[model samples]
Target: MRTLILALSALALAGSAAFADPIADRQAIMKANGKAVGAIAPMVKGEKPFDAAVVLDALKTLSEDAQKIDVAALFPEGTDKGDTEASPKIWEDMAGFQAKVEKFRADTAAAVAAAPADLDALKVEFGKVAANCGGCHETFRIKKS
Candidate 1:
């Protein structure tokens, strides 16, 4: 089941580039999100501790990788396709979109930097960091459930 999820997630990220322009940047961000989530799935499922150490380490790697994705570059004119659900508002509201992405990066960094030694406490804090994801997606990206 885990393998299936990972494979499907990878396919989604991998296939995302084929959907539109600025392929490199969108692909990078999706790939980074995939990698970050992959590293944390065990913890999320309770197979592992809500380990701050693990979360911190994963975010550290993810944060650096995420820097490669340029929000502006990824949404240039003519990038959209039939399959692309990215809202037209992304281009129209460029500044707002960029702010969300930047906040995600900063919040992830903050979560990692402040990761607690206690695992349970870590879980609570980590949730805040993870929420940054939906924060951006809610306004900018189109994803079904």
Candidate 2:
């Protein structure tokens, strides 16, 4: 009985993780973006002396995440369930959503390639990356109070 219970518990845990909701997965990805931004923001603001390596890591993370987030797969029917802040309009206007995603991907890639030499240079490239995030949030993301 004890062995059976342990086996069942392990299976349940594995199943839950294996089938983790896409909404949660995407939310985690966005959270990672925020973390990367947080790491770079201080240096960009001149609070911390600019570290080229840190900046590159942040930009690389942003670029990778932007490319990996598959909207079509993650936002499938009813993925808007639970605590997700995804707007219904994402499905309604997928073309626009995809455009925004592509823009972000391009902006991040450009920023990565430019490899800003200093805080001032990083600011301009970062602004474009930030704008892409803001533009999508303004239209496709629902604000949660």
Candidate 3:
């Protein structure tokens, strides 16, 4: 039984490590951030009726995702290949890239703090968060498609 348990644990760890791709990890994180924005954007745009709870949840998601992002570590050496959308300039201009990432984190946190109670307020707060995302994408990300 002990040997079996040890073997299972080793297999699990190895399986996870085998799928650990930094570029994919970062992309997944960014996709999560996008999903959060998508969830609330319609309400902010007045296309869908505002729901305070949903807005709060979306903001929370953004904040959580921002906190999880480690831009520097995610873009390690030789991670620029494969399906990565990250620009090579990210390594060359690391300071600028990190600054943009920090701005996105700050903006997401500010959006959470703003805690818009209505659509109008939510629009304003969401705009700030969106701008931060756009800034980072424009500077550091390349659209492969």
Overall lDDT per candidate, in order of appearance: 0.70, 0.90, 0.86
lDDT of 2 by residue, 19-85 (tens): 8788988998899999989988888777899988899899999999998889877888898778999
The TM-score, computed over Cα atoms with residue i paired to residue i, of candidate 1 is 0.68
Please identify model 3 stretches exceeding 4 Å from their true place: 1-19
Using TM-score, give the best candidate's number: 3
Return the candidate ranking by lDDT, descending.
2, 3, 1
Total backbone clashes of candidate 3, pairs 3 or more residues apart or in separate chains: 0
Candidate with maximal lDDT:
2
| Candidate 2: worst-modelled 10 consecutive residues by lDDT | 16-25
**Candidate 1 global Cα RMSD:** 11.0
Question: Model 2 RMSD to the real structure?
Answer: 4.7
Residue pairs with colliding backbones in model 1 are: none
lDDT for each residue of candidate 3 in 1-145, tens digit (9 for 90 to 100): 9999999999999999877889878888889888888889888777889998998998899888888778756888889888988899899898888887788889888988988998888888899999888888888889987
What lDDT score goes with residue 33 in model 3?
82
lDDT of 1 by residue, 33-64 (tens): 77876777678668876766667787777667
Candidate 3 local accuracy as lDDT?
0.86
Can you tell me which runs of candidate 2 are displaced by over 4 Å?
Answer: 1-20
Better of 1 and 3 by lDDT: 3
What does the lDDT read for residue 30 in candidate 1? 74
Q: For each candidate, what TM-score against the reference?
A: 0.68, 0.84, 0.85
